[model samples]
Target: MLTTAEILRKVRALEIKSKKLTTDLFTGEYHSAFKGRGMSFKEVREYSAGDDIRFIDWNVSARFGHPFSKVFEEERELTVMLLVDVSASSLFGTIIASKKDIATEIAAVIAFSAVNNHDKIGVIFYSDKIEKYIPPKKGKQHALFIVRELLSVQSGQKKTQLNTALRFFNNTTRQKSIAFILSDFIDTGYQDALRVAGNKHDIIGIKIYDKMDRTLPKLGLLRVEDAETGEQKWVDSESKLVRYEYEKDFFRITDYSNEVFRKAGCDLLHVRTDEDYVKILQRFFISRNK
Candidate 1:
């Protein structure tokens, strides 16, 4: 557990980082990307020479005996939900920050960006079970509180049951919102839940992984352990076939995950612990804007 002073210091540092990213990089891009989840009718006005014909309010125009167009302004205040995985596997990292750290940083940036755009941000922290939930709210303080929670929350389970988290999110959030699921995705059997949730809300998957996850170093014989399941094994990494099989397994894992996301109709972004995340996020935002 972190002491109160430690929590305070960490939260302050995260707030400063979040502010910088929110202002310098993400403000304009986030606005363009996440705005206009849907537009609401603002008013009706007389149709001009080049107004969109689709928006013509025939009933209103017929009543007034003139063509009118329904004007709509974007409902800019959207609910941004971060479904963060706190499984034990997220603690494993060989380069730079851990998966949990990257997830926290990304969540903080998104939360602060939402605050800047007058949107409410919430978080759902989970392992196999839901650990904590911060209901969506606006304001800088609320955003900071979410960062603190992401940095310090404890998980009641070690295994990852993404289905549980997805079902909980679908049931808890009534209004359609943008949800970012940050995880290593080390589990399976969540396709149905993800499909249901994705059909209702905009779901984006942020897969945080270490480089070692996909490729292994030639370190001769090495001991390995399953971080979440507490299983240990010895592997002869020096053998070419061993290394080839290990690399192939990683490919299979990624292929399966990619297919799951495709079938669910969701977008995915992959971030390695050693890479520059800012560029990944920027590129993601630009693609979505297009």
Candidate 2:
């Protein structure tokens, strides 16, 4: 649990960092990646040398006796939802920051990015069940409120059941939204729910992980407890077979998650806790534009 003062202080720091990243790096990429509802006609203008012939207004051109183009602008009103996982597994970290910490930062950045683009932002915090739902709204205040909640929100349950969150999100939000799911994705059996959400909304997954999740250190025998289930087990990390199995399990989970997103027609990005998430996000946005 975080003290009120501590939460406020961290929220302030995150606000500054997220806003800076949004302005200096993400604004343009985010805008291009997640487009508006559709294009609306603005007016008609005289066609220029390079203007597309397809847009030529036949009536306007006939009346003016010259080629005229129908100008249109993107209707840039969009809703962005952050489906954040607050499961116990997210607390595990072996490097600079915990998975939860990185998820919060990235969520803040995404909120600011959406706000900058004049879009509404909302959040759905979840563990094994729906923890909280912040309705979508526009303005900096709403975005800031989301940042604060992301830092302070807690869940009663430690397990992760993504289907619960996705179903709740679908029920609450009727309009198609740009939804980002931030999680370590340590659970399974959510494929059907994910596919349903993907059909209705634009879904993207950001998988946050730690280095230790992929490879265990050779520290001889050690007792480890399951963060979610509270199950305890002893394992000899020094044994090659034990280390191999640990690594294999990690990859197996990764592969399942990858396949789920791929089959659902959604994009998924992996960010190690210690790696540069900014670069990964930038690349993703740029690739979407292409």
Candidate 3:
């Protein structure tokens, strides 16, 4: 656990970094990447040559004896929800920063971007269950509160269950929202819930990982403990077959995660702890815009 001063310092550092990324790379892309719910009827006006004939107001046209068309405008206000995973697995990182650190930074950047665009921002922090839920709200203060919570949330239970979080989100939020799930994605069996949530909302997954997650170095025999379960085991890292199996499991998980996101019609982005997440996010936003 981090001390209050330490948490504050981390929050301040993340705020500075995320603010720069939000302003430089994600400002415009974030605005264009998400769209409003639907068009709203504005008013009826005399039909013009370029106006679509499908939108012609037949009753008004008949009454006025002239062609009239209904004008519609895109709803500008949007709601963005960040579904963050606070599972113990996020604490493991062999790179410069931990997976949790990367997730927190990215979440802060995204919240700032949404608020900057005049959209409401909300968050759901989960670890095997719904740990916290901050209702969607506008303004910088609200976004800051979320950032603070992200940095300081301590879970009594460390296990991960993505389905529970998705179910909670699906039930609580009725309106369409731009939802971002930030996690290391070590849990499974959430495909059905994910698909259901994706069908209702614009869902995006940011999978945070570390270089060591893909390939473990041969460090002789080491005792490892599961972050969530607290189970301990000893493994020989010198054996080639052991290393190969470890790598194969990592790839298997990665491939399955990608396929699940694709099948649900959602976008999946991979961000390593040592990589530039700002660039990765910018590219994702541009791709989504396209």
Name the candidate that leads on TM-score: 3
Q: Model 3 misses residue 83 by how many Å?
A: 0.5
Query: Taking the tens digit of each residue's C-alpha lDDT, what string does model 1 give over 84-115?
Result: 99989988899899999999999999999999
What residue pairs are clashing in model 1? none
What does candidate 2's lDDT look like per residue over 1-290, in tens digits?
99999999998999999989998898689988977656779999999999999999999999989999999998688889999999899899988999999999999999999988889999999999999999999999998899989989887788998999999998999988999999999999999999999998999999999999999999989999999999999999999999999999999999999999999999999999999999999999999889
Compare the candidates by lDDT and give the number of the best one. 2
TM accuracy, model 1: 0.92
Evaluate residue 126 in candidate 2 and report its C-alpha lDDT on the 0 to 100 scale.
94
How would the candidate models be sorted by TM-score, starting from the highest? 3, 1, 2
**lDDT of all the models against the reference?**
0.90, 0.93, 0.90
lDDT of 3 by residue, 1-290 (tens): 78889888887887888788888787688988876566789999999999999999999999999999999998788889999999889888886989988898889998889888889999999999899999999998898889999999977778999899999999999989989999988788989999999998999999999998888789999898889999999989999998899899999998988999999998899999999988888888898688
Candidate 1 at 204: error in angstroms? 1.2
- How does model 2 score by TM-score? 0.88
Cα misplacement distance, residue 163 of candidate 2 (Å): 0.9
Which residue ranges in model 2 land beyond 4 Å of their true spot?
A: 36-73
Model 1's lDDT to the true fold?
0.90
